[model samples]
Target: MASRWMWASQTIILLGAVFVLAGCEEQTNSAQETESAAVVSTPSVLASAGPVKTAEPQTPSMEQLVERYKGLELIDAHNHDASDSRYQSQLGLWKQTGLGRTVLFGDVSEPSAVGTDAVAWEAYLKYPDRVIPYFSGFDLHDPGCLQVIRGNLEKGYFGLGEIAVASTNSPVVSKVAWKANDPMDGYLPQIYDLIAEYNAPILIHLDPVGGEPLAKLEQALEEHPDTIFIFGHINAYNSPQETERLMAKHPNLYGDFFAGFTLYNPDGGGKAEPFLPVLKKYADRFMLSTDSGYGITEVRAIEAMYRVLDQLGDPVVQKNIAHDNLMKLLQAQPATQTQLKELRKQGAGGAGTEAAPQKLSKLEAGRLLAQAPKG
Candidate 1:
């Protein structure tokens, strides 16, 4: 009887040990599965976004950069400020920021035109050298608009537009905005002819981008080869290569470098790789601006537009884009110090503008830029 009891106890102990080992194996497998699931769920930062921009890690504050661009004087190729009061308010900012002059225009794409065209003229009269005026009509096709434009030119307006060729205006606004139409259609042909006659540049705004709009713009460029066209916002928002291609094909085309898009990384590192080549190749074709990226003052606009060029650090290239090229377009040569002094006194009608180009030293030019406010 004693021997049978001992054998039974030994068998129970062996069975218990097997069950204990199995439970430990199951627990180990469960722990591993939990860890594997956690590993699969997490994501790296770049997983969602294809490739990150390798821009400069550090950037300069806007004010710290003011003197770095020692002699950059800007001719803002495009801007819209319907408020005539801005002319008085923003004047000092313009002077301090080295913005020598700017081109102001009324935008026709808005619901309320509110005599913006007239206001631009008024702004020019108040600060003639600081503000170059452009005439904007509700419809370029309007029969009497020709007389209005001619009158503006006589009043010393510089050009015509912020003209909306194709517009997709504010959908949320209760009223319908300016209708988007074919740029080459309507009375634009006659109007363009008149613009050429006056020797004024025309700034056209075409929208909904790509497809037919670009085609029509190209047609306008082809048809009116005599007229100088500022392709506002450059190749209408595509690769800089497209802007370069258009510029290469058309001698009369000029581009405004605004749009908050750049081939530059502001950190003093990372080249706006595609940008430098085109800018160097067609140095004379583009001018610096902040079209509707209007700072509180003209100088603010100049600084904002020039931030990229400042990072790039080529003073010669900066001079051509900011001053000399636009001077060529305006049919005005760079002024001498004595000439610059005289220019400050005279308005847009001054005769001194046609004088020979003088190489302005950085210190002298920077001083003159702030002081000489001629258009």
Candidate 2:
């Protein structure tokens, strides 16, 4: 993790990058109005997977939102390692913040990175279904790298990434950037082939901030369309329009809307409205995340994200960004998405009524915290 202490800090007033333009962002809300309505009217696919049960959309309780979406599983597509200080409280923190899952990665250049990977692995082992691990990019032939990769695959590591190639001040990022610029660097093309075979997505951090240097990233995307590539924050270094252009052109390029609105919005969360149209238009191509790490847990990011969801305000769109898109990345399947749509149309009477992720009881949390590795 970066040296900055406030990884996803709850206390920091997250005013995203200060470079936001002052002019009115183009609003395309109406462009997708017909498409949205069509989706709603599509007679949800009710199937052989038991009768569907969905509840009416009343006031949006955490549970109401869950049931309405049918077994809603909120996923944070980007996360760094938990700080040693926060290790014990991480799960509790997630519970409080309504985060069901977090895709975890770390800086690859650090020797200690493997330790962080171990920490993430422990969390994955403790909460198999909720924690998905993605390793940093490395030479496939490196015995050490492959050993860890193969071991984690057996233990359920999800994919490779949050890896990036951007010229940056951070030493770790610079190293990754170097690897990215070299065609033969770490023999990535061959590795990407293996990843494609495994059916796993790779999270990439391309631009240091603004991805002005899209040439490298674009090349990789065009070359490996079969390899799922998750670009960093949708709102970072690139305007929403640019992000949309990339998504529209490349079917394999995905983005995580990593709560940039929280810091960048003039009023905080509502800043996301301008991008909602694009988000809905390419619903399956995006996922929501806190991108919280270092010392910060996801508490603030998750809250800010839900606030955006509330303002954006379409249930199906919300579910897609929240979890459905991620499930596809996770399992390479959409059975959950289809089932969710059917149940949403049916009105979840009891299906997935549990609003938030099931939490560890107080005692359980305390016990785990006590036993949490102090690294």
Candidate 3:
């Protein structure tokens, strides 16, 4: 009996040992499987998903783009001189950017009298080479104004006013209070007469407040088919329709995009979209000017204009706005032939005749004259 009981106890102990060994092996295998799965899965996940991406670089702003073209030659079609100090400061800025020449329109608001012409002449004499003066008309209502216009023309003034004509009202009849009036009647004929006589262009400041000015413009176009006019301050056009209609109708009419930066958002908050097709359609007629009055320096104003052009897309358009169109207009002028000769002579030690001379084109002489300046 004792031997049988001992045998039973030994069997039970062996069974317990076997069970313990099996449990240990199962745990080892499970742990090994979990580690291997982690390694395999990690590599597959890493392979499928690459590293994170970073942002791209940025482009330069409009102002910076303009600064790049500093020291380039530019012609300002419209400018004014109110004071000597202001004039010098403006001219200095112009020199920095290679301002070739500026067309100065005298203060038209000068009370209509001999004093106005004298003041205009004095301003011209102050900066002869730097400025091409435009004589102001006497009151369109006064016959004597025509005589003053002719006298200034004889003196070599390029064209007519920074003329303030209200398209809404006739400044001629309503001389005292020329509020905006549509169907501009009183002054259109007289102005047209002077424009025709001189065969010179007139700069008109049309009212932007109402469509009245545009209506007056249309009437004027019908009356004077041959009249050449430049709409000063493109901001006055107000709406796209007026701009398109007038630009399409008048070959001789042009737009000056000066002060346009301000008028762009009269309400003070909106995008100033490019006059797109308007600029593209009449790129030839359109010209850029600072219209930077007495306060702003010429260089700063010119830089501002260039900044606007830089945002205009591509260098070609920028070059056209900066130089080409103005060059074309300058070349078209009858004075170019004589001007070139004088420039050549000035280049040489020879005296550049101050007065405007008659047409003299001797190719050989001109060529020699050109060389003398360089030598």
Best candidate according to lDDT: 2
Model 2 residue 281 lDDT score: 88
Count of clashing pairs, candidate 2: 18
**Candidate with better TM-score, 2 vs 3:** 2
lDDT of each: 0.54, 0.54, 0.49
Candidate 2: tens digits of C-alpha lDDT, residues 119-216: 76666645555567676635433546555554554444677765554445344455542235432245566666666755677776554444444765
Which wins on lDDT, candidate 1 or candidate 2? 2
TM-score of each: 0.65, 0.65, 0.62
Arrange candidates by TM-score, highest first: which order? 1, 2, 3
Model 3 Cα lDDT, one tens digit per residue, 88-156: 334434543445666665444235423434544544454444455565546655566566666665444
Candidate 1 TM-score, C-alpha based:
0.65
Please estimate how well model 1 matches the true structure, expressed as its whole-model Cα lDDT. Answer: 0.54
For candidate 1, which ten residues in a row score worst on lDDT? 1-10
C-alpha positional error of residue 207 in candidate 3 after TM-score superposition, expressed in Å: 0.8
Question: Of the pair 1 and 3, which is ahead by lDDT?
Answer: 1
Model 3 alpha-carbon drift over 4 Å, by segment: 1-67, 70-72, 83-85, 112-129, 167-184, 259-272, 293-300, 314-316, 335-375
